[model samples]
Target: MTRKLEGQITIITGGARGIGRGIAKRLAADGAQVIIWDIRPEYFDSVAAGFEPIDTMAVDVADPESVATAAQTVLTTYGAPSIVVNNAGINGPVVPVTDYDFETWRRVIQVNLDSVFLVSRAFVPAMVEKSYGRIVTVASIAGKEGVPGIAAYASAKAGAIGFTKSLAKELVTSGVTVNAVAPVMVETELLEQMTAEHIAASKAKIPMQRLLGIEELAAVVAFAASPECSCTTGFVFDASGGRATY
Candidate 1:
């Protein structure tokens, strides 16, 4: 590896497993010091053993207080992070809007959408002070093209994309770049939350007729978080396997 991100400090929310784990490992390998913030830290030891050592903190990203506390810890322990990946999210029940539970819809939006706002608000000022940062949100293709049976998840992701655009513009002249990565179905434990039919339908929408690879998504995110990605901000990088156009 070229170590393009050498000495950079990075934070990845929901990095205990799945897509978040993949991105964390990739960033660490590229020489960034990675810290994981997940609601569950019991699995951190096992996951960290498989790759380079990564610091872990138990955090409920959806909680404003929790994000604030964790952000302070990161700032004190690792100094200001040059990279922040807002990847914590959930797939709400596979039910139609008419059948979806109102509370569950709210929960999904809080976790997937509000967490982004809270976490970014907590750390962005430090980045602005230093005049350098990379903020990447893991959105979904469903956000761009709504999918049936996952209204809550899709709506939250759409909010994420919108947030990315808005923040990018706000920091356009501050040496901080904000962007998003929209991927189609990926082979992650989150898939277990969806029905088999839903999974199949998502994969079929991709021209590749396959789910995305964890490392593949990590590679794209690594680029977006790197110093080389200087000219693009507020852009949604696609990892949809040809499923997204426009």
Candidate 2:
């Protein structure tokens, strides 16, 4: 690693486990002072054991108040983060749209989509003032090509992608880049939220006939979060293993 993010402050939401955890480690390794905003900060110690210490704050990214408070604390303590990864999300129940519980649908949207808006809004001002920033959202292949059983999850992710593009354009001249990474199914604890049948179906869509690796996804996110990715904003980097046509 070239320490491309040296002297930068980075934040990763949902950094306690799964894809978020992997990204957190990668950013830390890349020489950013990494801070994790997760609902389960208890898992932070375990994730930080062999690496440089990472700051952790218990945060419910979906709640406006929680995000506001956390954002205040970070700005007060560490100044504005130069890198923000909107990786917190939930895989809503695996059910058809007609059978989906209404409350669950709202909850999914809140966590996966609404949080992106709140978190970005909170930190972007400081980033604009500083004249440098990177925002990366962890989206999914389901966002681009819908999945049958997870309508809520898919819809929220699609919204995230759109939000990234729109925000990127809004900040284009401000030196703040907004982008997203859309990966195919990865073998993470999130898989526990899906049905065995759903898992099989998802894997079958990939020409590679395999699940994406956490490290692979992390690598893509690292680049998007780095200064080297200077020319691209409002772009969705694909990690679909030949599954994506566009």
Candidate 3:
């Protein structure tokens, strides 16, 4: 009777709530020691309540120094993480690219795209040295189809997907795996970024004709972040409800 991720050290960013929290719960339930990294400390109390042996760190994943400090703490406290999930992201305001606020666009890219780069770069070397790791990033279908209004969000996720592929190749022979999950409209707090009309239109385009459930998404991510995910790297697994898969 062995759990798949027993004793593995896992880091889950944006794990305080929503999809990230779901992934943390799944990993912890499977015997992994979970560390939740997020921008808000308040959510940590609520997040820590549902699980045992889970710790939280207030981290600004978009900042290099913050990520570096957190990385050091992780290395010192529990050694290198065996699994890293770059799941923190934001869906910026739904607005046409032509009229989108410049600063907002940059902020979106920094958080959604740059944070993945910063967080992974900080811990990947350690993972390589250990010669065992799983990196799962959350991209979006908007990245594939350029979902009109949310150009910044789409562009950042596209960068995330590309980053995952390139990083996967870099560590392909290092016994580390990197993959991205491209999800369609997911039912989470992130949806608040969209208008009612936007949400409805997005849902209409899904082949499943509905938003993806958080638990369902968590299952796919958990599989991608496990030791059992031995043969897949540099690939994007589709969780878009058939919205777009190639």
Give TM per candidate.
0.97, 0.97, 0.96
lDDT tens per residue, model 2, 157-220: 9999999999999999999999999999998878888899999999999999999999999999
lDDT of 2 at 191: 86
Writing each residue's lDDT as its tens digit, candidate 1 over 110-191 gives 9999999999989899999998999999999989999999999999999999999999999999999999999998998788
**In lDDT terms, how accurate is model 3?**
0.89
What C-alpha lDDT values do all the predictions have?
A: 0.91, 0.92, 0.89
Residue 58 in candidate 2 has what lDDT? Answer: 95
Give per-residue lDDT, candidate 3, residue 20. 87
Q: After TM-score superposition, what is the CA distance of residue 148 in candidate 3 from its true location, in Å? A: 0.7
CA shift at 64, candidate 2, in angstroms?
0.3
Best by lDDT: 2
- Residue 221 displacement (Å), model 3: 0.6
Q: Quick one: RMSD of model 3?
A: 1.4
lDDT, ranked from best to worst: 2, 1, 3
Give the TM-score (vs. native) of candidate 2. Answer: 0.97
Clashes of 3: 0
User: Considering summed lDDT, which 10 consecutive residues are worst modelled in model 1?
Assistant: 45-54
